[model samples]
Target: MAETIEEIASRVRELRELSKVTAEEMAEYLKVPLETYCCYEEGKTDIPASKLFEIGQRLDVDMNLLLTGEEARMRIFTVTRKGEGVEVERRRQYRYQNLAGKFLSKKAEFFTVTIDPMKEKPTAYSHPGQEFDYVLEGSLKFYIHDHEIILDEGDSILFDSSYRHAMEAKNGRPAKMLVVVI
Candidate 1:
């Protein structure tokens, strides 16, 4: 079974408490509303992978701890078998499978993202650093700021993640892509 959002949220709350960090402090650090952080702890809302990574950094824990409830001790190399990667549910239409969740002190976060088609427009999000996305299957409608780009399988793009960006599935089907954030 894929990892549920509730389980991840619970781990977030637990780690925050163990670290003795207040919700207000986390909210301030994330630059999000206090209620938003509270919702994340309460499992009332799905937490973005980027936000979870930020939490891991701020809480001085590895992202694997938050995603798998297990610490990554290997600094050399780690391999996640096919169909065994940690699944992260960031939104109803977005499913992310962490490709390097077991490697310690990762300088970059990698994921295989599966995006389902939506009737409504997707919300764009921004974070510090840069992002590279390569379409693996199907097609995607990608938006960066006010520019829109259509990417088919085998196409790739790299951009500053600070700009608001979002992606939607094309042809009313699910799309898959490889995403690396650094």
Candidate 2:
């Protein structure tokens, strides 16, 4: 089926409800009026690209996901830092296959993400937690719902992971990012 603005808006509204965040609160987060925010969610008004990007950032969702409703989940493998060189833990694999959901463990969560230049757009994941991401190399386009931000080498963004969000490599360049969810 062809995608429609209303569909995107409705999905976003559903995600917001799932997050247990109210429209007024989201509006506060976006620094927009409640009515305007409602209009975006209701699809009564066209969302500006930049504003949509802001909503994505505030909601912690991937702009593309919000726009296309496509799945971007994946299985990521990485080595534990305390180990010699690399030790794989089958249980600790990072799966972006679904919503990260609530953190079961109080301990810190970490994931090593690698983006290939030729790969399709990455999926968006959101949960109720805090996150810190540091770029190891190259550049990435970070989308928290409609919001898009670029991070170069050594750049980082720390924010609540509860927002719907996703990330992608810019210019088809390979990028590596270390994500810590707490």
Best by TM-score: 1
Listed in order, each prediction's TM-score against the native is 0.95, 0.43
Across 1-182, the per-residue lDDT of candidate 2 in tens digits comes to: 23465876897798789878999998887666899889888988655433544565666675445555653343353332322221111111111111221222214445566565545565565665677889888888888867899999999999877687777777767777776666
Clashes of each: 0, 17
Model 2 earns a TM-score of 0.43
Worst 10 residues of 1 by lDDT: 1-10
What lDDT tens digits, residue by residue, belong to model 1 across residues 63-133?
88898898888789988889889888888889999998889888988999999999999999887789999
List CA RMSD, all candidates. 1.3, 12.0
Poorly placed runs, candidate 1 (over 4 Å): none
